[model samples]
Target chain A: MDPLSLLRGLLDTTEDAARALVGRERIRLAVTGLSRAGKTVFLTSLIANLIAAGRGARTLPALSDATGGRIRRVFVVPAGTETVPRFDPEAHLGALAADPPRWPERTEDFSTLSIAIDVERRTSLGGLLPERRLTLDLIDYPGEWLLDLPMLRQDYATWSGETLARFRRGVRAAAAAEFLAFLDALPADAPAEDALAKRGYTLYRDALRACRDAHGLRFLQPGRFLNPGPRGEAPLLWFFPLPEGARGGLADLCARRYAAYLDDQRSTFLDPYFSRFHRQVVLVDVLGALHAGEEAFRDTGDALAAVASIISGANWLERLLGAAPTRVAFAATKADHVPTRARDALAALVEHIAFGARGRAAQSGAAVSCHAVAAVRCTEDAVARLEGQAVAAVRGVLLQDGRGATIYPGEVPMKPPEPDFWDAGLFTMPEFRPPRLDPAGTSGMPHLGLDALLAWLIGDLL
Target chain B: MSGRPTPRVILDEGTAPAPRLDFGWEVQVAPPVPPARGWSTMALIGLGAAVLVLGFSLLEAGNFVAAQFAQAAWLGWLTLAVATAGFGLVFVAIGRELRGYLALGTVDRARAAVARGDPAALRSALAAWQAGLPEGRAKPGDLGNMPINAACALVEAKTLAPIAQDAAALGRAAAVQAFAVTAVSPSPALDALVFGWRGIRLVRQVAALHGFRPGIAGTVSLLRRVAVDAATVAATDVAVDAAVRGLLSSRLAEHVAGEAAAGAVAARRMMLLARAADEACRVLPR
Candidate 1:
C-alpha cells in the first residue's frame, strides 16, 4: 500500500476505537444565500459528487484516487439518532442522474446528515498504513435564518424604527411600507396566523432587501418574507423589531424573544454543525456575484462578513473559543464559468472578497486557503463563434435562456500553486449564465482538492 | 330473622397472665423539660424561706428577736410557686406549635397527590412529574425503563395545551430517543413514542438488521431487546399507556384504575398514530 493510504488506515482504526469509547462524533456544515443564490443546486451537486466518487464513473478525483490525497469511500448513514429519518442519498443522487440535471428542492429548518468516508492523507509517514475513515457531518438550512441573527442583537423598536425608515427611502419602500403597517398592528401575545404573519414577514424581508439596497446590509433572505420553510412556523421564529419605546416596553419583548431565537438557532443549527468536523469548506458562486454587478458583489462581501460573524459569534465562538479551525479552505465555486487561463484570477477575486475586512472574523486562525473548483466538468478547450464573429472562446456547457448553447466561455489554464499576477475587475460581462453543461466523460475523477481539504482538517485525528 | 338457627358458641377463652411489665421509665418517658429560670432563684428563695422559717421557729421557741422576720417566709414561698408554673406554660406552647406545623405539612402532601391524580390537572402534573424525574442522569440503556405514565403525559401536553409548552422538550426527547433507537434495539413501542412508524422505516434504512457490528449497533441490539420487553408490558397495561401517552404527548386521562384495558386500546391506536407523528417530524425543503 502507498504511504498516504497506510496512514489513512491507521487513522480509520483509531477513529473506530474512538467512536467505541467516546460514542459518535458530531460535525456540521451550513449552506446559505441571499435570495435566489442557487444554494440548493450547489449543495445537491456537492453531495452527489461526494457520493459518486467511488462509483468509478463521474467520481471526484480527490476522493477516489490512491496515489494522491483523496477520500476512499463515502456513505450516507443515519443522522445523530435513529428517531430522525436517514439522509436521503437517493433523493439528491437521483436528481444529479436525471437526463437534464435539476436542482434539489430548497431545505428549511436546518437539516443534518452524518456521512462516513475513508480519506487518504497527503503527507506520508511511510508505507505502514492504508486509509482511515473521516466523517463529515453536513447541515443545510435556508438563508432566511441569517436575518434572525441581526435581530438577536437588536430590539423590536430599534429594528422597527430602522426598518420603517428604510421603507420610506429604499427601492422596495412602497411594498415595505404596507407590510410594516401590518407588523405595527400585531398584538404582542396573540397566536400567530399565516395571513397576518405572512404580511409582516414579507415586509420584514422587503425591509432587509431595501436596507441592503440603500445602505449595503448583506443579510437579505426571504428577498421579501416569502417564508423560509413551511408557512405559519415563520411567525414563531422570533425576530427583533425596532422597539416601540425608548426606555423599555416592546424593546424588552423584542430583545427577550431575540435572545430566545438566537439560543434556538444555536442548539438546533450552530452547535450540531461544528461538533463533528475539524475543518470547513465554504463555497461561493463568484460568477453569479460578478454577473449581478457591484451591488451584488458588495452584498456578497457583506454576506461573507456575516458568515464570519456567525462562525465567530456566540454560536461558533462558544464551541471554538480558543481552538480555531485546524484547516479552512474558502473555495470560489463554479470555476467553469471563467476561462481556464483566468481561473487563478477568479480564485484571487474570491480570496480578496472572502478574506477582506468583512470576512476577517471567520478567517481568523487556522491555515486559511482558497481554490477555484468545478465539481462537474462542463466542457473542454475549443474556440467558438458568437454574435456572427469568431471570438476567443472555450467549449463549455451552457444553459442559455432555457436552451442549450454549446459555447466556450473561455479556456481555463491549469492553475499554478501560487500565481504571479491577477485582477478581480477583468471579467466585466453581466447577463452571463452557464449553458446546461453536459456531464464530463467518465474520466477517472476530477478535483483532488476536496479530499485534501478534508484531510487537512481531520487527517491527524483520523 | 327468626328462621335462621343460632349456632351454639364454644369459647376457648382462658385467662392468660400478662408478661411481667418491665418497661423502663427512663426509656419510655419523655425527657424532663429544662428549667426556664437559672438555679440562682431556687437557691436564693429556698435560703430566704428557710431563714424566715428558722426565725419563726426561734420565736416559737421563745427567741423574741428572731420572731420579727416570720412574714418574710410567706413571700419567699410565693415566688418559688410562681416561677415553676411559668416554666410549665412555656413548654406547653412550644409543643403545640410543633404539632400544628407537622399537620400542615401532611395536608400539603395529600393535596399534591390528589392534584397529580386529577384528569383535569393531568397534563401539567405529568410535566411536573417528568421534569422532576431523573431523565438527564439516566445511563445509556436506562431510557427503556422510562415510565409509561410520563410518556402518556407528554402526548397529552403536546395535543392539548400545545401552545403553552415550547419545542425544547420535544427536541430533547427526540435526541434522547434517537440515541435509544439507534444504539438499542429498534423497539416499536419506544419508536411509537419517539417517531412512530416512519421512524421505524428510517431505522431499517440506516441500520442493518444485524447492526453495524462492533460499535454502537451492538449496544443498540442488546438494549432493543430490553426495551421491547418493557414496551410489551406497557402496551397491555392501561395505566402504563396513559402514563406513556401523558409523558410523550402530555394527555392525562380521567381513569387510572382500568389502565390495562385502556392501554390495550391505546397500544392499538398507537400503531397508526405513531406513523403519523413520524411523518410530521420529517423536514422538507422550501
Candidate 2:
C-alpha cells in the first residue's frame, strides 16, 4: 500500500477512535454529479429540508415517516471544521431566497457540512428511550473532479493512448485540432522545457473546455485542467496526455508529471473521503443531456457508468481503497422541468442510463435506486388546452423573459430516444426561473420526489 | 404565502382549465416546540450546580476546620487532611465512573458501525471489540475474503454466541443462589446482604465475560437498562417468563404464595438481565 494511503487509513482510524471514545455515530454522504446536474441545489435543499423538518415544516416526509417521527432535531455543526471548509447553508439558502430567487452557486471544490440528527428510537420496552444522534457529514465535490476518478487505474501510457484516441473522434477532433497541431510540432525526443509544457497544457485545457462548451461533451480527463481548483494554473496541472509510443525527453517529462497528477488524485481526492462514506447520491441532468442531443447523452451515460462503477465495477480497487458505497441513488434532477405523467419515464431513462451502463453494479448488493427529483421546484404542474386538446403542461416564470407561461415542455422517453424521436423534433425545453422562497427555508422548499430519494438513500439510518 | 402578485400564465387560443398550483408544490408549516435545550446545555447546567454545591461544602468544611483549630491544634490538622483526602477520592471515583460510561458507549457505537455495512467499519469495529478480550482466544477459521454480512454473522455466532452461554450460566447460578438464600434466610437483614452481594457479583462477572466491565455508575446504568429490557422481554415471552407474567397479571391466586414466589420473581429478573447484557454486547449488523 502507498504510504499516503496508510497515513489516510491511520487518520480515519484515529477519527473513528475519537468518535468511539465519545460514543458518537457518524455517516459521510458524498453528492456528485456532472456539470449542470444541479448538485448545489440538491445539497442546499437537502440541508434546508432537514433543518425545516426539525422546525416542523414537514419537508422531508419520507425520512420523517420512515423513523416514525424518531428524528428529534437537526442542526449544522459549528464552523470550526478541521477536515474541510464548511458548506454554509445560510449563504446557499440566502442565494435561493434572494430577491428574484435564484439557485445556489454550483460546487466549486469539495466542502463539508456536518448535520447532527437526534434520532429517538424506542427501546425493546418501548419507553424511556434516550435519543441517539447520527452525524451526517454531507460532502460536495466539483463534478469535474469525477472525470479524474477513472485515471486511478490507468498508467500514463494507457491514459495517453486512450485520451489521444478520444481526441481523434468526430467533434472532439475538430475541438482538439489546435492542441493536436501543437503536439505534432513538439517532438517527443526534444529537451524538457517548461515553456513548451505550459503551451501544451494551455492548449489542452482550452481543447477540453471547447469540447465541453461547443459540443456539450462531458468526459474530459484531468478535470482540474479545465476548472483549476484552489491550485490555480499551477505547473502540477501542466501536463497533457502524449501520443502512443511517444517516450523520453518532453514525453518523459509529461509522463512523469502525469504520474504525479495521478498520485495527487489518489492522496488528496480519492483516499480520505472514499475510505469513510458508505452512501452516495449521483445527480444526473438527463434533460440537459437530452436537450444537448445524442452525443452529450451518451457521454452523460459514460460518466454515469463511471460514477456507478465507483460502487461495483472497480470493486478490486475500491476494496483496496476501502471505498465502496453499499447503497447508491442515481437521480435525474429538475423533474419539474417535465410534465407530471412523464416523470416515470424520466426515472426509467436515468435507471436505464445508469444501470444499462453497468449491469452488476446495482445487482451486487449495492441497493442502487433511481428517481426523478427536483431539488427546488421552479414550475407548477398544469394542464393546458393546446390546439383544442388538453395537453399536460408546466406553468412557471420563463427563464428567458421572466414572464409566466404555460408550456408543453415535451415528452420524456423511458429510454434513449430513437432516431425518429429526434428527427420529429419532440422536445421544446424552455428553462424556468425559481419560485420565491423563505429566506430561512422555514416554509420548506418545493421539491419533486426528493423525499423518495432520501428514503432510498438513508432511510434505514433514519 | 408570498406578498408578490401572482404571475399570469399565457394560454393558447383554445379551451382553458387555467393552470393552478398542484399538491406537489404544497407547503405547510406546523407550530413546533423546539428541543428547549440539547444534552450539552443540560450537562453544563448540572455541572455548574455540582461545582457550586461542592464549593459551598468545601467552604463549610474549611470553617469547621478553623473552629477545630480554635478548640485543638492536632485535631484541626487531622480533620483538614481527612477532608482533603475524602474529596480527592470522590473525584477519582467520579472520573472512573465517567470512563466506564464512555466504554459502554464505545460498545454501542461499535455495534452501530458494524450495522452500517462498510467493510472498513466492520474490520475496525471488530478489531476494537476483539481488543477488549484477553489474549490467547482461538481465532476463527474462514475469517478472510468473505462478504461483510457473512463476516458479521460469523462474528456474532463464533465470537458472541458462546459468551452468551457463559453469561447464561452465570445468570443461572446467581438466580438459583438468590432464590435459595432469599427464600430460606434466617433474617431479612442477612437475606438483603447476601442478595445485594450476589446481584453486584453476578453483573460484574457477566460484564467481564463480555469484556465490558463498567464501573459503579455504568453498572448502575446498565442494570437500569437491563431491568427495562428484561421487563419488556418478560411481558412478551409469556410462556417462558410465567413467573414475571404472574407478577404483572391479576392471577396471583394461581401460583406459589409469600416470599418463595417473590424469590422466584427475583431469580427470573436476574436471568433476564444476564440475557439482556449479552444481547447488548453482540451487535448484529444485518
Candidate 3:
C-alpha cells in the first residue's frame, strides 16, 4: 500500500476506536446550494431552531430528541479546524432579528460552525443510557464553487469544447454571443499574450455573470468566475477556454493555468472539505428554476447531477477505511411557494431530477434521499377563485412591492418536464417577502417540512 | 398691508420669462437611417483592384522589367494575392463590426428607456444593459444603485415605514448597549471597540433588507471606504444628513443618528462611513 493510504487507514482506525470508546461521534454536515437557494437562511434558521429546541422551546418537533425531551443542551462551540473561518451565526441572526426581519445574505465562501448537542439515549436493553454529546459541525459554501468539482477530472480542451458547445445553444448562445465572437476573432496559433488573455477572461466572466443574473442559467462553470473568493481575481483566474483545434503558445498557456486551478481547487478547497464531511444537503431551488423556463430547469438538473457525482466518487482509501459514509440529501427549497397539496409532487419532481445521481450514490454504499422543504415559510396556502373556479394558491406579501397578493402559480408536474411542457407558458413563481416574526418567538422562522428534513438528516445519529 | 413697505416682486431682465414653465415632455425623434450594407466590402475590393492594376503597370514600365513574358506571370500572381487579401479582410471586418454594432445597439436602447424614467421600463432596461455589454464593462448608473432603488421602491410601495421603524428600535437597543459599555469602562479604546462592533451589526442588518451580505472583510473595507467617501462629499452636518438620507431611506435616518449619538467622535465618523459604504456597495453584482 502507498504511504499516504497507510496513513489514512491508521487515522480512520484511530477515529473509529475513539468513537466506540466514548459512544460519541462527530458529524460534519455540509450545506451548499446554487445562488438564491436560501442556504444562508437555512443555516441561520437551523441554528436558531436547534438552540431554541434545546432551551425547551417549541421548535423542530420532528427531531425525535427535541420532541421526546431527550435533548439536554445545545450550544455553539469553537470549530475543530482552526484554519477554517467560523460561521458568523450572530451576523445572520442579527439580520433576521432586526425589527422588520429580513433574510440573511447569501453564502460566498466556506464557513464552519460546530454545535454540541447533549442528548439522553436509551440502550437496546430498555435501560437509560448515559447522556451522550454529539458534535455537529455545519459547513456552508457557495453552490457555485461546488459546481467546479467535475472540472478536476477534465482537461482544458475537453472543458472548453463542452462548455462552448453548451453556450452555443438556446439562451446561452444569445448571452454569450459577444464572448463567442471574441473567441472567434483570436488566432488559434498566435503566441500567448497577457493583454489578450485578460481581455478574454474579462469578457468571459461578464458573459457568465449576465447568464446567471439576467437569464437565471445555473450551469456556468469555473464557478469562481462568478463567486470569486478572496483571491478570485488573481492571475490564476485569468484563463478562458480557447476554441477547439486550438494549438500553440496561447492554448498551452491556458491549459497550464487550467491545470493549476484544478490543483488549487482540490488541495485548497474540495479535498479538505469533502474528506471531513459525513453528510451533505444539496439545496435546489426547483420552483425557481421551473419558473425561469425549461432551459434553466434542465441546466439546474445538470448542476445537481454533477454535485451528486462528486459526492459518491470518494477515493479508494476512504472506501477501504469505511469512514464517513456520506448520506446525501437533495432538497428542493422554497416549498412554501407551492401550496400544501402540491408539495409531494414537488418532491417527486426533485426525485426525478436527481434520479440518476441518487441511484449512483446508493450503489456506492451511500444513502441518498430527496425532499421539498421551506427553511423559512413566507406564504400561506389558500383557495383563490381563478377563472371562475376554486384553485389552490398561496397568499403572501410580494417581495417587490410588499403588498399582500394571492398567486395561483401553475401546478408542479409530478415527473421531469417533457419537451411539450416547454411549449407552454412558464409558471409564475412570485418572490415572497418573509413573513413578519417577533425576534423573541419560540420558532425562529416559520417553515414547512424543515422539522421532517432535520429528522431525516440527523435522527439516527442522535 | 401690515408691513411698512410691502416687498415688490422684482424680476431680472434675463429671468423675466420666469423659466417658461415647460411641463410638456418631448422625446426627440430621429429619422431612421438605412443600415450599412456591403458598401465597405465593395470599397475594399475596388481599392484592392486599383492596387493590383497600378502595381502591374509600374512593373511593366520599370527598368527592372527585362522581359515582356515576366510581366504576365507577375500580373497573374499579383491579382490572386490582392483578391484573396482584400476579400478576407472585408469579410473579417464586417463580421466584427456587425457583432459590436448589435451589442452597442442594445445598450443604446436601454439608455433611452432609462431616460423615460419609468420604473418597470428602467428595470427592463437595466437588465438589457447588463446583458448587452461586450465585457460587462458598464457600471451601474446612479439610479441603478440597489439600496437607493430598493429604498425608493419600498417607500413608493408603502413598505419602507415599517422596516424603518424596526430598524430604529434595533438601533436604539444598540445605542443603549453602547452607552452601557462606555459608562462601565471609561476607556476610549473600549468605547471605540464597542461602537465598531455595534456599527458592523447595524450595517449588516441594513444590508440584509436589500439582500446584500458583505463578509467580515468586505464589511470592514466598506466601512473604511464609506468614511473616505462621506468626508469627500459632506463637509457640514446638513450635508452629512442629506447624504445619509439618500443612502438609507430618509425614514431610517433616526436609527443611524441614534447609533452615532452613543459613540465617540471617531466611532461616530466610522458609523457614518459604514452607512455610506453599505449603500454604495449595494450596486455591486453579487
Best by TM-score: 2
Candidate 1, which segments miss by more than 4 Å at Cα?
A: A1-58, A62-72, A78-80, A83-85, A119-131, A150-199, A206-218, A221-227, A237-240, A243-260, A274-277, A313-323, A356-363, A379-402, A406-462, B1-286
For each candidate, the alpha-carbon lDDT, in order, equals 0.44, 0.72, 0.66
- Please give the distance, in angstroms, between residue A237's alpha carbon in candidate 2 and its true position after superposition: 1.8
Q: Give the TM-score of chain A, superposed on the true chain A, for all candidates in the order listed.
A: 0.67, 0.91, 0.93
Span of ten consecutive residues with least summed lDDT in model 3 chain B:
B20-29
Error of 1 at B211 (Å): 26
Residues A414-439, model 3: lDDT tens digits: 99876656555555466656665434
Q: Which residue pairs show collisions in model 3?
A: none
Q: What lDDT score goes with residue A174 in model 1?
A: 55
Interface RMSD of 1: 52.6
Query: For each model in turn, which proportion of the native inter-chain contacts is also found?
Result: 0.00, 0.15, 0.00
* Backbone clashes in model 3: 0
Q: DockQ for the candidate 3 complex?
A: 0.00
Tell me how each candidate scores on DockQ against the true complex. 0.00, 0.07, 0.00
Off by over 4 Å in 3: A1-6, A65-68, A79-81, A124-129, A315-317, A323-326, A440-442, B1-286
Evaluated at residue A12, the lDDT of candidate 1 is: 50
